[model samples]
Target: MATSTQSPLAQHWGYYLNGVEQAFNWPKTFILFYSSSTVQKSLFKSLFLNGVVFFGGLLILETFYNGPEHRILGCSYANITGFPMYIALLGINGKFFTPIAEKAFEKQAKAHPRTTPGSTNIVQSMASMIYTTIFYINCGIFAAVLRSLIPHAGPFLSFFMNCAIMAYYAFEYKWLYMGWTLEHRLTYLEEHWAYFLGFGTPITALTFFLTTLHSGAIFGILYPFYVIMATMATPKPATPYGQPLTSGKGTPTDLSAPNKVPIFFGVRKMNDLVISLAKMMGGVQVDSIVAEKQKMMKMD
Candidate 1:
């Protein structure tokens, strides 16, 4: 909120600003908005959305069979494709990081918006694109790392979970976020209970599939970090660091909302199956079935 260069993180996040785009000249910048229905309505447009066809084209060619040893963090693509649930969601999945983009845009606006309507409008539009690109790159690098780790996973679990994560996030963005922010504001803070139930649908489905598909390494292997990412995305509004203007920690602000939208909307969240899967692995299924079996045996 304050533009007077307060701390290190503020300094760090400044490179991604709009009026400063020429100063940042990232190979390309992506401008995005909340509406998925529209395409490139703002001054800045992210190429990430356009990559849907490229990934689809690759699916047609089936290039996964004979490509260079994807040294992606040391795992092979085969290992990643092993799980039926880990397919990367081309570029369309960038929705999860919109908060970060907004933060950067606001920061730039605070810093460089001139005292004229034309100048302010141009700065805001351009800043949005630059910030969007930075957020996508951040999500993508982590996602790529996630993809590399699952190279040894099965195709079914690998791609399905990936799709499920992306799909759930889509709901988080389009539904949950709208329900909470816009819908609640319109309804004046009284939200529907269905909103809460729907919050974790994709997550619930994902947990069910993971338990059925990848029994062994489900929880112990990959659930810790996934949980952390989910928490961060649904940050409390008091969240301080919008986007670091500098690198080191700056002042912590109550920037996030307590009921912020879950980040499954972002391309980053892998899934929310950890706790449920953990419970299932603890043998709850056997306990429930034991009662059913007892009833049948009594009849016999």
Candidate 2:
């Protein structure tokens, strides 16, 4: 009697979560969130803080010595199709999305007095940029050392392996339930899935190669991943580790039982949002246009 609902979304999320748990199993897939936390927490903090210094170091060199004149927000090729788009997608969040996060940080700290929340936007952004830099640098050295050790490695082979690993994780997030559906846990996994999609595109490969080999071509590629991340991100609900929003209509199993927490985005933004009749998709493109930019940037 309980088999009626939307096609894919109809199924309750409890089962969905089972899939998530299996997917994040570290040994099964080396690409995972825990790998990010392998370092001592204090050392991790120091690493990102140092990453901030490293970013500054590069910027300093560019600004004074080499001309780090390009804006992180600007693009060399401004489309979602190219290899560069991948890096822009990932990197743009630090430049553009950090503000929304910072606001949340301030509010969250005040809301939960005793609870120890994570670090600040400044730190998180530093972490992303810093870690990204580190990954690329490491990748470069590995490429160089391995080339002499195993010169048989080629672009096709490297790309194939990267794609294999990345595709597995990406699909796992889309279809599998990798964790408990508790809002906190769900939210955590959502970020892990959405951001830091490792080695997904050629630009990603380039960044890694450039960092280790000092290849300028590889260096220019990091921007698009950041851009795509900011532009294409599904405005994930603020809820953490959400499985199914418990239903509270009539039956005892109603999830609307608790004072329902608000959706991440407020009505102000979604209000009167336009949708296309054909696509059934409304709202503007994820690309940061003039209007979205002004609003997000708070610059009139």
Cα RMSD of all models vs. native, in order, equals: 22.6, 22.4
Give residue 205's error in model 1 in angstroms.
8.1
Candidate lDDT scores, in order, read: 0.32, 0.32
| Candidate 2 local lDDT, 172-257, one digit each (tens) | 22221222212333233333332222324433354434432223223322322222222222223222324433344543433322
Tens digit of per-residue lDDT, candidate 1, span 182-286? 222212111211232232233443453443223212321222222222222221122233433433357444332232333323332221122234346765344
Candidate number of the best TM-score: 2
lDDT of 1: 0.32
Worst 10 residues of 2 by lDDT: 173-182
Candidate 1 Cα deviation (angstroms), residue 25: 41
Error of 2 at 240 (Å): 22
